[model samples]
Target: MFKIDKRYAKANNQKTIRFTDDLYMQLETIAKYEKISFNELVLQCCRYALENMEPLEKE
Candidate 1:
């Protein structure tokens, strides 16, 4: 079994996601440049998107 970080599991319900090589490489580069773990970079992206998302229209 894989060892998961308890903090990540608790905060985000810990799910796995797959990315294309191009996208993954891009994120990897950005993460390295930012000097953060890949997981931390992903988490930051999720938080930013959620915070900036526009509301849906009413039916």
Candidate 2:
């Protein structure tokens, strides 16, 4: 019997996407070089962007 991990199951339920082979390879390379999973890399990027990205000021 195969029991799905809860975290994976939750992630699987989310609506999003399939990366192309080239992008996957690049993510893998970056992950390996940084000793982090590709998912972690993407999450870190998202967090950083959300924290630092500023919207335009309305005049």
Candidate 3:
């Protein structure tokens, strides 16, 4: 099950990413509703995606 934890450790690294305006608004809205920072939501999403991703078939 995918879950969001409110507590997070301080990040030691930083990254720059770009998002479409529509996607940005959607994420921002969700973060507000979830009472978490947009960054946290994005991090959780990325982590979940990686953990649950299907392995690619050998070509």
Candidate 4:
């Protein structure tokens, strides 16, 4: 059986997404540059964005 990361499984709720061609190409290039799989590159981006994303404060 395939293994799952405990941290990723914690975010198992279903979600929607759509990526632009430019974004896909950029990620693919980043994956090649880093010598990591495309999926791993995307995952790292998600993790990084989540960590850095700040919610807007309510007025």
Clashing pairs in 4: none
Candidate 3 contains a number of clashing pairs equal to 0
For candidate 3, the per-residue lDDT at 11 reads: 50
Please give the clash total of every predicted structure, in order: 0, 0, 0, 0
By lDDT, who's the top model here? 3
List RMSD in Å for every model shown: 8.1, 9.6, 1.8, 7.3
Model 2 agreement with the true structure over 1-59: per-residue lDDT tens digits: 22212232122334466889998898689767777666666556555667677987899
- Which residue pairs come into collision in candidate 1? none
For model 4, the run of ten residues with the poorest summed lDDT: 1-10
* Model 2: how far residue 54 lies from native, Å: 0.5
Model 4 CA deviation exceeding 4 Å by range: 1-17, 55-59
- Score candidate 1 by TM-score against the native: 0.70
Candidate 3 yields a Cα-based lDDT of 0.86
Alpha-carbon runs more than 4 Å astray in model 3: 56-59
The lowest-lDDT stretch of 10 consecutive residues in candidate 1 is 1-10
Model 3: weakest 10-residue lDDT segment is 4-13
C-alpha positional error of residue 1 in candidate 3 after TM-score superposition, expressed in Å? 4.2
> After TM-score superposition, what is the CA distance of residue 8 in candidate 3 from its true location, in Å?
3.1
TM-score of each model, in listed order? 0.70, 0.51, 0.81, 0.59
